[model samples]
Target chain A: MAAHNTVATSNARKQVAAGGWLWGAVRRNGAGYLFLAPWLIGFFCLTLGPALVSLYLSFTNYDLLTTPEFVGMQNYVRMATADPKFIASIRVTLLYVALSVPLKLAFALAVAMVLNRGMRGLPFYRAIFYLPSLLGTSVAIAVLWRQLFAADGMVNSLLAQFGVEGPSWISNPNYSLYTLVVLSVWQFGSPMIIFLAGLRQIPVDMYEAASLDGASPARQFFRITLPLLSPVIFFNVVIQTIEAFKAFTPAFIISGGSGGPINSTLFYTLYLYQEAFSYFRMGYASALAWVLVVLIAVFTAFSFLTTKYWVHYDD
Target chain B: MTDAVHEVPGRASTHPRLTGTVRHVLLIAISFVMIYPILWMLSGSLRPADELFGGDAGLMPSQVTLQAYSDGWFGLQVTFGRFFANSLIIAVLATVGNVLAASLVAFAFARLKFSGQKFWFALMLGTLMLPYHVTLIPQYVMFRSLGWVNTWWPLILPKYFAVDAFFIFLMVQFFRGIPRELDDAARMDGCSPWRIYRKIILPLSMPVLATAAIFSFIWTWEDFFGPLIYISEMSQYTVQLGLRSFIDSSGTSSWNELFAMSLLSLVPIFLIFLFFQRLLIEGIATTGMKR
Candidate 1:
């Protein structure tokens, strides 16, 4: 019996030692990697691997049907030097992005403030405002945008009421880009929702304190709300910037997929889509894609680096 | 906020500002303006093909008929039923797939202990930063090579691989908010990891999962680009792509039919938002918090 007890004690001690060693390894390395697996697998298969291939393909003159011929740097040179449509698309896209992002942020912030005003049926108003954002990039809205923007459509006819003439907003090169920008801004719901969330996180007592101090509402807002809300604003700005840069559907649908009226509304991605799918310039399209990625990354990094001056996260 | 905490309280009310009545009127006016376009589209859908332009425009249709709706639903070549079904199938499957795969991966990331997790996380996040067009052609080639073009495989398969890292990251942040004590207690009760996940985590995760599902549904339903690129066969067209066919590229387009079809197609999504708006808002609001 004594001998058996001794053996059991030894076995138990060994087991504890092994467990300790395993736990040490887990504490050192296991948790983060374990949590990372899904993203890792997804990144490798869906992003990294595909990105590498896209880089390689940018140098090859491969349409879907033919074997990829090594074209070296011809695609890049042509896009940089020879492509008129490429330049037009870039100019249009930059204008669209610049207008859309700031306008969207402003509109979203305004709506967020209005909704925050202790109103009855706040949820309903929010839901209503958010509907466009949910449906904005959609074909239905794009289709509706086309219908409403067409000559003799609802908008122009409404304008006709005031003895004002409205052009063919979707068909006219001069105004179609505005229609796209309007479409982009209408989808301000996502940012508004984010702003609302950020607003809620601000301590209400600060506003009350301001009220007690006789601070005007505007003063309270600029002094208290804006600074505190800056982090969320920063987040929204970066996100909306990227989203604007990637805007494709409304341009594609509203312009009837030709980016027509002389490619006035041909956004970067829409142009990329045309190059790859419509013109079969797969190599050039790939190069365009890399450029877009670089542009987005640079912008995002810039936002992060500059955030130190404004963004306030309560640790 | 820090400054607001120290404000002088007495002077706020003395300042002339938007009084209650004026504020109310202004809000109502703005609301009407905001809603006018949607209202106009709705009414436009009801106007008959010829009367859409021939008559003076009115807010309400003179001859209120379901003809346009019927035509949109029962019309030849691109019937609403098939498109609706296609949309429904695509939305539901993609939503289900995204929520399930995202949640599982989120679980592994939030709870499990593995190796090289930060590097993998950074890589996953890096995917979000990549312009989707960067991968567009390569993905197309991959699908073409697999002969998955003209099929739902292209639309659905990548999602299963956790193609959307944003949602995964969102779910992981949500899952981490859960108390680890529950998992420890379940382990003490001899529950396997899968059993714990099925029984406890999923139930607790209902709100976020709904958010993911709703978001995925809307995104997939709205995604015309994918359908436009991958599905060439008319029979396989999703609602968004199918609607595009109504617009003739050659000459004058059918404005009435297009408006009618556009309104009809928007109904399902609008209905969904109307029903689930609170859930959507709460979902977006609560997601990504350190909880």
Candidate 2:
């Protein structure tokens, strides 16, 4: 038993002596890697592997059934020079991001401000507002949207009662995209919730002091509210812009997955899905996908770059 | 929040600027618009078919019927029950996969002093912004080759490997909030790191875990795109897919029955939202910290 103990001690000392810092780290941090194994495996195999494969696939002329053949810059060239629907999709998405983000933010802030005033049944009111965000992108909601905007649907019925004429919102090229924009804006609960959290962080004394100084409510809002909430607003802008860029389901379902009514609602992802699945042009779709990522990255970078000008964190 | 209380101790949060009837009136009106569609849908689903489009649209249907519910039960090649089962199996398994795997990976990042931790954390964050579409076709091809297409494997299995970076980031944030003293005390007692995690970390972190589970269930339940791309078999269709199959907007769709089934599909998420709104809202609020 003593000999066994001495052997064990000697082995431990040898392990301590061996490989110096590397082995020490391996022993110390091995559990971390073990814990991280699932994520690491996923990071490499699912995310990085697929990402790299798509990058390579973007340069190939692969259909789903055929082996991808190297085609260099052909896909990129076609996307930039040949695809009009591509340009239209980009335009629609950009217009969407431009219109929806500000409106949604404005609407969300307005509601959040009202709710912030210690309303009765605050939780219930908050829940009612938030219900749209939860249901906004669901298949049910999309279906409901299609019907509600149809010429004979409830919206038109409501308009008839008001003695105003309404177009078939989904089928009219002019109004098709705006219908989606409204739906997107309607889900403003997310940002509203976040805004509420940000509002909670603001010191109410600032408002009280400003009021005591005879500053108008508008003056206090401009001086105090906007600056303090800028970071949260920035957060909302970045997230919503990215979300707008990726808007797919409502367009897919409502516009019948073809982004019809003159391609006005052809969100980028919807078009990409068709290119890959419908046409089986996986390579072209891959190129479109890369362009989307680059577009999002550029916008995100732009937001971050401009944030210092507007988002005051030091207060 | 403290300042709000300090300034208006008498009435917790009422703003002095906004007062009485007018504010409530405007709020009630806007609230009506916000909630109108759902109320309309609930009523529409319950209404008789002829009454659906006629007269003023109101929640009061002259006469209601259960016909839509029964017919929509097996309206397609499969039944709504099958779709519900499919969704339930996928969601429950996914919730389990996400909660366990995310918490495990989170434990590594939050507690263990590992090399390349910051790099990996940033990489994880990068994945949060990486839209699933960029990875969609390639994953489809991969899963197609592996014979995972039409099976729930493609939708369900990646979750087991902690592929959802959002959930991991959430869990990481949560694990960081847990005190380290329990870990230290456990280590001093000659407990393995795994023991520290399983015995101490898991028990105390129930609220965050509950948040993750609740979210995973709802998101998976509502997930339209993943299943849309992956599964084509009617037998394998999730609730969203089943609901979509009922919709042929340009064709003959049983609108009343579709509404009934849609309402049925919504019940789980609505229930989840109703019961767990506080946790869900708080979880999302903290996660909005990520951006």
Candidate 3:
């Protein structure tokens, strides 16, 4: 009986010791936890919780009005086999990502190189270039783009002076997507700024040395500038690609939220917006969203994996 | 030849004066092309509707008028004034929340020692890359269930939680640059962590905070997706939604009025850019270089 009493007291003591350790931890790092509380709450409640629920919702049939009913892989199957618009959206988005990212980066790099030449009034030039990027995604800019590309609008008026008739670029299925691409290219300012910063990091002596060696300007650019700038180029490519994939506002406004002109401007995000909001196909939209997430993840991972081949580091 | 060589070290092949002239001319032409569209839009807003199209594509308006401005101001069912007010309220609230919450989180990561700090920081950075579409549906459903579909709460509340990981990341980078000795000295004065944060860190961090605030305000003001998805009522419409509605409700008839309102919508962003250009450039350079 006495031995049993000792054991009981020891177990109670152990429990108290464990509780003391926890409380001690709380006291030691209490301020840190307090500072982190808001982000912690946001992370779990808004980010992680919603992501998990979205994953579940992707497999179900749900409208806002009805309780979700599980439908297995039906939505994914339909997207692959039955839905031609899904196929078209994927094609258009892929084409857009392929065209706009490279074109924008090239234009940005070309302009950045020119601006990096220690010119007079550089800030004025830089700000002018950047203004469009700041305003690009706004509804007003998209509205302006629609009018500018109309058959009877400013673009055609200019074209008429040159004796060339121009089609309404915004309404032509053959040319509609290209207008959005041009719009994306026009906002090359942010990336150009980034490229300028990267260019400044490259030492000037290298260029001088190349000049001494009688390397042609073009040759020097290919050998010296391209290699040194690869990492920045890589960063720009990944960022711009992701942004292009998610391009919505311009497409929505320019197409009048129809993604029409024979669905030529059917960006993946716009289509997803239509499904979820317009058609009330929440489940299908959730599936589409997951596909986009997977595409982005894979692309990011692919970029990282291939970085060793091209992306240089000072280290 | 000797004088030419002495004038410019590397460019012995061409006259420096000629090259300089060419470069300046090129830059001026590029600048004009870059700004021509905006100039045209501005001019279009001032011109009479009949004179807006099928004319010489010129920057000057034959007759300047404020008719479009007045018409656009009262064009829609709800006036542009109401939309501007709604946008202002949402943007201001969002900016305040982002700056305050992100700064607090950044301070903890930069200064405080704790277990799993590295883990939590990594998670925060991971969310920076995760596409928002993955979470959009569930968040919409959550807000709808709470009956926040037609309210500004859905747009404004997530900001308070520091869901904008970019701002937190930006502040963290800025905070780490600050000397740790200041924090240690503050602690020696028997100052609480919160007090040190308030007194020592925040005052020195005005530039970063301002950068974050400016960006947050601009992004929120320009956000069409959140407002588009959540607020359906014309009364609660943001400027972006209002602008979109103008296109739909008025069709193609009020092109001048549409241009007028569109230009007005850009005025606030333009002002912010004008005043805070240095901060914006530095913010972009610093965050981008560190990445």
Candidate 4:
């Protein structure tokens, strides 16, 4: 009985100590917490909460009007087996990511390298190049792109001077996706700016030393420039690839929201939008959303995992 | 030093003047190609509808007219002026909210010490890479349930809450660059953290604040998907939606007018870009390099 009484007293003392620590922490962090309240509220209400709810919704069948019914991996199964549109979207999106990202990065790097050469009017050139990236995602640009790729549009009209008739690029499934890729590549300005910044960080003496050693410019680029720029390249690759995956407007507007010409331009996000908003398959769309999340997570993780092999750090 | 290093090889191989001329020519050609489409669109908008297509590929209108612009402005039931007003209100509110809330959150992260701060910051960065689609559906449902489906609240309210982690990250980086001695001096004067944030930090953070505001306005103005999903009412349409409706409702019949309105839609962004080019470039460069 005396031992039990001692234990109860110790427990009470511990509770008081814990409470005091909690109170002290609150007092110490009150101002910080106050500053963070808005963001904390947004994070909880909008991002994290919605993400968790979507994960749950992915397992159900919901249409916004009806209560969600548990489906137990049916959406996943259907996507793998039954849905050809899903397959087509995955194929198109993968093709886009595979094509656009490298091409954009290559173009960006090439431009950045050229501009890095102590050229006059660097700001003028940079601004001109960056203009496309700023306007690339707007509806106006998408509308312009459609007209520019129409059968009798500017591209074909330009080609007409060579006496070669270009097909309606926007309508041709074989070429529709390529038009989107070109649009993505045209916005290489942002990445070019990034590459230029990265290039600026490289020591000029390295190049001078390489030149002194009789290394050709090409040789110097491969040996010194590439290794040094690998981190920036990796960053651009991951970012551009993810962006290429999420590309919707150009595809949506170009395809007229149909993902047509046999789903050639059916970007994953476009397909997801159609399913959720157009078809009101909220649950299935949630599942699609999760799949995208997983795909991006995997891609990012894979990039990180593979970084040691190629991405170099000064440290 | 860089100029000298760059000149050394050029001087050895060829005349520096000759190389400079060649470089200028190459850059000029590339710039022309880069901006040709916009120039072409501008020309198209100036031409009569009959001459819009099947014309020469050159960016010069045979006969310029303001017919397309006037027609486009009053083409829809709700004038393009209304859409511009709607877009301006939303963009301005979003920019103000983003700059204010993001700065506040960024101040906390950069200046103050608190428990779980590291974890929260990590989570915030994680959201940067997390695609919007994951939370998109649930957010739609939430907004719809709150009857925000056809309102600008869904568009503008999120900004007030600092959902744009990119701006927060950008501001945090800028804030860290600020010397903390000022804050310490303010504290020595018995100023509170809020006072220091207002007096010391914000006053010194004009560059980053301007950067955030410009980007936020441009992005909000260009945002098609958010307004597309939330707003279906034609009268409440933003500029992007208004332009899209012009395409759907008129098709190719009013191509010149479409081009005119499209060009008009881009004017605000173009003006901002024209003025804030330096700030925009610096913002992107600093943030990108710091990464």
Best by DockQ: 3
The full ranking of all candidates by lDDT, starting with the best, is: 4, 3, 2, 1
Candidate 3 docking class: medium
Model 1 spans > 4 angstroms off: A1-41, A211-214, A313-315, B1-18, B54-57, B249-253, B288-291
**Each prediction's RMSD to truth:** 5.7, 5.1, 2.2, 3.4
What is the lDDT for A281 in model 1?
79
Tens digits of per-residue lDDT for model 2 on A57-164? Answer: 999998999799999999999988999999999999999999999999999998888778566777887888887887767798888788788877888888888887
lDDT of 2 by residue, B171-204 (tens): 7887888898888988999999899889988898
TM-score (0 to 1) for chain A, all models? 0.86, 0.93, 0.96, 0.94
Ten-residue region with minimum lDDT total, candidate 1 chain A: A30-39
As a whole number from 0 to 100, the lDDT of residue B90 in candidate 3 is: 97
Candidate 1 chain B, poorest ten consecutive residues by summed lDDT: B7-16
Model 4 ranges with Cα > 4 A deviation: A1-22, B1-16, B289-291
Model 4 residue B7 lDDT score? 71
Steric clash pairs (candidate 3): none
List, in the given order, the native-contact fraction of each candidate.
0.56, 0.58, 0.66, 0.73
Q: Which tens-of-lDDT digit does each residue in A58-171 have in candidate 1?
A: 898877788888889998898889989989998998898888889988998987887775666677677777777777777778777776787877788878888888888888
DockQ agreement of candidate 3 with the native complex: 0.62
Candidate 3 lDDT over A70-154, as tens digits, reads 9999999999999999999999999999999999989989989888868788899899888888887899999999988988788
Chain B TM-score, model 4, reads 0.94
Q: Which of the numbered candidates is closest to the native, going by highest TM-score? A: 3
